[model samples]
Target: MATSRLGFSFLLSLFLAVACSTVARQLRFVTVIYRHGDRSPIKAYPKDPYQESDWPQGFGQLSQVGMMQHWELGQALRTRYSGFLNKSYDRQEAYIRSTDCDRTLMSAEANLAGLYPPEGSQLFNPNISWQPVPVHTVPESQDRLLKFPLLNCPRYQQLQRETRQSAEYVNKTRENANFMAMVANETGIQNISLESVWSVYDTLFCEQSHNLTLPPWVSPNVLQRLKDLKDFSFRFLFGIHRQVEKGRLQGGVLLGQILKNISEAANTSRPQRLKLITYSAHDTTVVALQMALNVYNGKQTPYASCHMFELYEEDSGNFSVEMYFRNESGKEPFPVALPDCPQRCPLQDFLLKTQSVISQEWDHDCQVPSTSQDTEVIIALAVCGSILFLLVILLLTVLFRLQAQPTGYRHVSDEGEDQP
Candidate 1:
């Protein structure tokens, strides 16, 4: 009976240990990247009647619906991570970054209002439900580090040119040539191209979403094609010829920064003060980050869509990273998978997979010399030579004319004149 009792106690102990080990996953850190909420179209097509005045806040400014969209997203985040975050606002616990655009800035502010509503004595104002939270940003002009679809990278521009020249791109263009031509003719938009079609779609999409009547030219099929082209344009922007290199210069810069933050958060010796960091920017930003992680679904991320990176530390001191994207306001954020890894990938493996795309010198890689550089130099030298040739001809003409004419002081002998 004593032996049986000892055996039962040992079995119970083993079962308890197994159960504890199974439930030991702890969330260490979180990073979120989200597109700014809805807004008026940045610009309109030639035939578009909806002017800036049509929008309540004018063009490119966030609408009231946009504010509510972000506010709700913030509340969802609050509920999702309530266990990990503080009950009240904590400055050291969270950091927020946004692009220097007014829409994105306002969106961040709105999001923070929902994420951290003051409680207890923290509420200074009784009527207002919002409190101020610091949002950090660098000037858009100098912000190559965080911005996506980075416009200043010369190498990236070169890649775009190459991609356009690729046979696949050309073939796709050919396939859509008839459709694009029809769109241009029917819409009365002059000089329309595949690249600029997205703007047209955006305007129409915004109008439709806001319940404005669309032009007769914009049929269901037309809308679908517009969306397809827009998705293709985005893919062509970051992919096509040398996708990995393009990602490194554009998305990978931002990814590198995010990785550094996660790495710091994972360091157990540190205070772990920063539990969350949120980036509020554009749809392009969300797509670029996902593309860099090899998880893009080739669809345009909806407005106010969010991509979340979660870090978990197991009991054995191993850390893993998981990614989720909340594209729809109604549904839960879905898990995203990394290439050749599980949905919840080990942190070390995540870093290793992304090692190739991590840019060492962003400015250097972005300025990578191409054959076009030589072409530019040649063109410049040719221009200089042409100018020099013109100057030389002018000088020769002046000298010849001077020699042909008599000087101000001339001798009486006309045939062989000499200065007195």
Candidate 2:
């Protein structure tokens, strides 16, 4: 009886140990990257549904809907990280960063409003729901012009040029002809650019309503078609199946940052995981990062779309990273499961399991296949053209040497006078 009693105690202790480890494994560190919430178009082209006057808040400002969207996101974070972030905010534990844009800044603020609501000592006023915390940012001008700057990376620009010029992209644009005609009809504008068509499409879709005072030329069929085109474009940008591989590569920088952060967190020795790392930037910021991580799944990644990456250290001290996305849809985010790990995969192993994903996602060609289709030939042609130009210049120099006047030899006229 005594021996049986000891064995039961030991088993109980083991089970408790396992359960504790499991709970710890469930929680790791977290890094979230998100775009700002819904807002008006930054600026409309010559023809768009909402003129500046249409919105009381003006263009690019976060709407009340946007605020609610972020507030929901914050609440979600609070729920998700309830045990992790503590009931109160701590400077040492949590940090938030936002782009200088009003929408993003405000979005982050709204999110925090949800993440860390006031409780106990943290509350300045007893009646308030939350205490205010700082959301960080650099100047918008600097962000746009310099520092993590977009100086038109020649490589990305070249890729963009190639992507735009690709038969697929060109054809897609051409197929959008009906969309162009429809926008032209609505705005009463002549010769609408492909981009203008998209701008108008976004305007109408975002307004969530058709123009009440539609121009006489506007057709309901055209409106429906434009809406379809808009959906297609959003799918092209963020959908799982449509966005090309190259875009996934071009936007890998932010994804790289995500992995790097996980790696750092995994390397740390403590119960404290990276509480939070918030990225504040444009819609492209979210898209690029998502594409690199191969997570966007070709959705529009609306303003203030936030991606949460979590890493949990297991009982054996192994680490894993789990990815989560919030897009103001108030739905559970799409999840990417890494192999050799649980629902929450270890960071290092996640990186390894996902290396192929990263490689494929970003369109890196380091391991070119033995065979390829037309793209390879186009690449070969460019390379050969470059090499041929170099060779031609070399040949020209040689020919000039063979046929040219010798040094120290001068031509003389019949009078034996050397030419000057």
Best by lDDT, which number? 1
Q: Name the runs in model 2 displaced over 4 angstroms.
A: 1-21, 45-50, 141-151, 188-193, 209-224, 227-250, 269-274, 328-330, 338-343, 353-420
Model 1 pairs in collision: none
The lDDT values for all models are 0.88, 0.65
lDDT of 2 by residue, 1-420 (tens): 999999999999999998897676656568887777777766655655558888778887888877887888888888878877777888778777777778888988888898888888888988888788988778766553112323334434444445556676578788877767666765776877543455665665556532245544446676676656654554344333323343334454455556776777666554343467766566667665555455555556676577778877677777666777776566777776533466566566667655643443223342333343358788989999999999999999999987887778866678876768
Name the lDDT of candidate 1: 0.88
Q: After superposition, how far is residue 303 of candidate 2 from its true place, in Å?
A: 5.2
Best by TM-score: 1
Candidate 1 residue spans exceeding 4 A from truth:
1-11, 370-372, 375-420
The TM-score of candidate 2 is 0.72
Model 1 lDDT per residue over 1-420, tens place: 999999999999999998998779889899999999999999887778788889987888898899999999999999999989997999999999999998999999999988998898779899988788999999998787667788887888888888989998899889998998888887678877778888888988899989999988789998998999999888887776788898898788889999999999899888568899999999888878877777889999998999999999987989999999999997899999888999989999999999888998888888858566788888899999999999999999999988998669655767676759
